[model samples]
Target: MNLGLKTAVAAFALTTMALTAASAETRVTYKSAKTGSSYYQMGVELAEAMKAGTDGDISVTVEESQGSVQNVMEVRARGGDYVFTTPPALVGLAQGGKAMFEGKGDPAFDEIRALFPIPSLTMHFVMSADSGVTDISGLAGKTILLGKGSFGATEGEKYLDLFGLTDQVEIADAELSNAVAALKNGQIDGFVTAGSYPAPNVIEAAASTPVTVLSMSDAQVAETKRTKLTIPAGTYAGQDSDIATTSLPVVAFTTTKMDDDTAYALTKTFWDNKAKLGDTSPWWNGVDPAMLSNIEGKIHPGAVRYYEEAGIALSDAQK
Candidate 1:
């Protein structure tokens, strides 16, 4: 072979190796919890599905974190390949909520997208029934602990923003576990948690202490509409007959960085295995595969591919 031709062939071989290695090494990080909560479990399920559906073209690793806020930061930093998060936190990150990233900075809204609209998250404000806190206003002058990051904060802020309760309530932030402990120890007058129905932590906290789960009033619900929200039915625990409550919408967010093929694969795998995931997590029972269309933020290209292939129409914005 000519000397120049030999060099060219060597270079081509090296480039091919590099590309193959990169493709084979594509890794996805999924953050959830170690305690095996339904949310975390669902994340694991999705990650596993993606890996399997892609036939090892992509590999996902599940890790535990402080839930949505941490997931958002990790994915934004490229530390996480994908994240499972609820809508309010996704919006809060977009709006730059305080104490986020330890004030490192706000989440870059443009870099993020919604993979799917998760089932509704019932915002739980647990107060002793005897505490005479029948309405949101009644919680005023009491020491309240909202879940850490923005889970609890969003609910309290939303309620306050909507009901003009800024001057009425005193709010503090606490991790979900700590907030539950605080309520049990009488260290806090009330504890707030926003999650899918029968949130294990809230249920455990409520069982330990007699408490009431406050529902959003009509006006408060209206304000929530200003943000992207969904209220699917059949998602609550003890939510029938005795303590019935309506649904609230929440979305599972992703980043814009996910490639079209990968995103489509993930979306397709999730929908295909929806029944199994729902059976494992009651919170997902009523999630209509059809509702994936309404998720907010920019739609991912992969998701677009998957939906289109599934015969679901896409908006121009999605394409």
Candidate 2:
């Protein structure tokens, strides 16, 4: 071949190589609203798993807590590639039921879809047993610190309403740590938190001062579940033991607009390596593949693809 022809062919090959390299690089960012919490730790694990599962083709950046509201906003703005949120948050977004979301107008929830529903989270209406606080209904007229910007806050209110104690209780908004501290300092009667068992924060307080986890009778559980106030097993760390408690369902979600291939790949990568992801924090030990995508709103096409490929049937809505 002529030397000039050989040089032109080599340059063409180099350009093609560069294009492939760019296409092979995928950058996806995952943000969780619960910063410094077990949820964030789980996200980090999921992010790492996704990176490794994709054979380094897909890269993930995890930023904990931009707040659930903000996370939803980011997803809508096309700023965030993915996020984790609770069922109430998911339902509120899907149904435009943001009667309590602070700040700007509600985003379009119909645009969001469930990636999975983590195990149910027991709603701990915490107080010192020494304070004579046993049931949520007993905390009437007392200050209750509920975690802010979380579905826990909504659950706490629902708990109050479910038990006909709404008018009896005074809601105090505070961060998890601060609320726990407030209870310790006698500023508030108790703090309400919802999570899978041995809820780290609630356990932290329980370890310090003896606290009681309330389990209203089956009748109450039914009412709370129906009304959105709840506690669920696996929420406490010692589920293998005799501790029995019901919990509220907490669903995690992502946007519906994501392409099917991306969602499918993301879901598969995360679940396949889920065991390793939980190693970072025991909080994720409860995440089950069976629990994935079990709540309201239709599953995103990507999620549907993953489930179907795995031999799970897709719902009619998903189809």
Candidate 3:
């Protein structure tokens, strides 16, 4: 072969390599909640934060998820670049192979890792009428629909057990999607739901008919080992006073399949840019570094690296 021809072939190979390297971009799929929900909004914000934080080096694709259960279920079919959010307790149930995960356990759940807490899943025990029942105990002797297989359902039932209302309250087996209509029609006395406050369904229920947002006492909140939050009066139509409640902390999670570098970048971007996100969203304001204590599973190594560099204390689970 002529020397000139060999030099030309080498140049072509070098150019091809340069192009491949330049086009290399890390892509991640962030699945959280259904479209039009606050969680979905967070996903979008976080995606933007990731891109901006990395100067467009990393790209995130936000995908709508049905719910946490559906999000966790997809981990079995997802690859390393997949990330999702859920209440930390749900991850515990998944690991233990309990609740909806019963008889459906797989090695995939074991690979689940925590990223960071977004916000607490505040429980809203919305009643159809202003029954003057002040706290969770009011469920006694009332027919309540707690839904099924959701973080809300399990956590709500736990509250019922804690408050000793299990035997006293009649639990309906109806679908939660129709809970608002049922409440308006007087089909059930009330229902228990856990989500960010001012939940859309709760608002719709309050607007459609007379409603009450019951409050839990401080003692009840302490007993639940969850966070205390108050839904201030006027948050809903005709609501007259603040309602106390407990909330289950929620966290973003990923599988161990994600590489440490990508995990670190995602976590770092969130912490560095969260203040900017908070400027436009009230939910981001609720998150803090201390909430790391609430994450139940192993923290992703990449996120761990960021926390360590930032001098954030690691939770016992993470350490």
For each candidate, what is the lDDT? 0.64, 0.66, 0.85
Candidate maximizing TM-score:
3
Better of 1 and 2 by TM-score: 2
Q: Can you give the lDDT of residue 181 in candidate 3?
A: 86
Comparing 1 and 3 on TM-score, the stronger one = 3
Using lDDT as the yardstick, the better of models 2 and 3 is: 3
Displacement of residue 30 (Cα, Å) in model 1 is: 3.2
Question: In model 3, which regions exceed 4 Å deviation?
Answer: 1-24, 98-108, 127-130, 137-191, 201-212, 222-243
- At residue 193, give the lDDT of candidate 3: 86
Model 2 spans with C-alpha error above 4 angstroms:
1-15, 63-66, 73-76, 79-111, 119-122, 129-154, 165-176, 179-189, 195-197, 225-257, 289-294
TM-score of 1: 0.64
Query: Which segments of model 1 are wrong by more than 4 Å?
Result: 1-27, 31-41, 51-58, 63-114, 119-121, 140-143, 147-149, 161-189, 208-210, 224-259, 290-294, 311-313
* Cand. 3 TM to true fold: 0.73
Candidate 3 local Cα displacement, residue 86, angstroms:
2.5
Could you give candidate 3's per-residue lDDT for residues 168-210 as a string of tens digits? 9999889888899888887899988877766777888889998
